[model samples]
Target: ERGLLCALALSREQFVTPGHALVLRLVRLSAEATAPHVEPALLAQKPLLDRHGNAPVYVAQNLLEQLAARFEFSASDDEFQAYRKCLRPRSLDENAPRPLVGRAIELLQFKAVIEATQECQDGHVVYVRGMAGIGKTRLVSEFLEM
Candidate 1:
């Protein structure tokens, strides 16, 4: 069937394996996290998507959707693309030598660092100056979501 073929193609794509695994894990984490068509039968099928020189694809939830409505932000596809383009990691393929705090990591104590230290801003770009391993960029990046 056409649907099956699409699923097959998706399963063959990169991140499908890790995503499938994450889905399995999420089955217990949150009901809303499951993909629309994620079923046990599908899980029974091949979960390990063949890695064919393709990288993982991450789809981030728009946490700022409500904020966008409150303020002025683009809800259109084009606007979303532009916002994402700005936040995407440069040279993501280049692995970091040290294991830094990945954006996906859950609630951490360093979150309070933002609260502990306060800086006045005039609603403009401000650089977070810091030393190595201080998580300055990561702090800004956490808000990026994806």
Candidate 2:
């Protein structure tokens, strides 16, 4: 009952319409269990939901199967562990430095250009045009990071 109400609210907030790609992705994810009890709600809205699509019915059926699979005992412990890991989000190191090749000289040139631009009079614009694949973006990012 509570889960059904929550599901209704979630669907409304997230715009979870029938036939949307999001429904398929949500069904496949390990966090499928975390979704509210939406079966009853979906059934109630079957007429309107199914008017333009039958995908919601199929997605709901697949979700039920996945939920049932969670309760079943696994034959292989390794496989089960792998499946669990897929559900967990990967962590990233924020302290890690950005990956950039040799650009120290270019950065210095860019800094000099910026200083020169600041000293320029009114209506003067400094354009840093260069060939593609040059370290223009990298130099700009490095300058901003400082």
Candidate 3:
């Protein structure tokens, strides 16, 4: 609370100094640090509760909400909307990569090798090496989606 009071009392110019800057940061951090708010009804629902409990899930949700509320992307509504769109989750179909085009065969081979190796009793390393833009990354990504 004293930090907050000190931060409020300091002028913008005072904030430029290292000592004042530290005070301002500490106040900002204290302001942003909040406990998660979970409903009693939600807590009562066993299926709704994560095995680890609600704190972690609600903490993340509250943090994201706080961030979204605080975020300022200019006064333009379009800019704010654009920023909000980026925060939304895409549908699975939307997330799926475009027809992996020329890498289909390699993708299939990679998937096959991965599946075959899963039964191995010993640990093994699978390395994908290729020049840039040759779709080595694309192949791995496509394989992961499988």
Relative to the true structure, candidate 3 reaches a TM of 0.31
How many clashing pairs per prediction, in order?
Answer: 0, 0, 0
lDDT of 3: 0.40
In terms of lDDT, the poorest run of 10 residues in model 3 is: 53-62
On TM-score, the candidate that comes out on top is 3
**In candidate 2, which residue pairs clash?**
none
Model 3 Cα lDDT, one tens digit per residue, 1-146: 23323333442234333221111111134667875423322322324222331121111222334334322212222312211211212234655445665777787787677777777755557798988877787778778888
Q: Quote each prediction's TM-score.
A: 0.19, 0.26, 0.31
Error (Å) of candidate 3 at residue 106 is 1.3
Model 2: how far residue 80 lies from native, Å: 42
The residue ranges of model 3 lying beyond 4 angstroms of the native Cα positions read 1-96
Report how far off residue 145 is in candidate 2 (Å).
1.9
Ranking by TM-score: 3, 2, 1
Best-matching candidate per lDDT: 2
Report the Cα lDDT for candidate 2.
Answer: 0.43
TM-score of 1: 0.19
Model 1 stretches astray by more than 4 angstroms: 1-51, 63-88, 91-132, 135-146
In terms of TM-score, which candidate is stronger, 2 or 3? 3
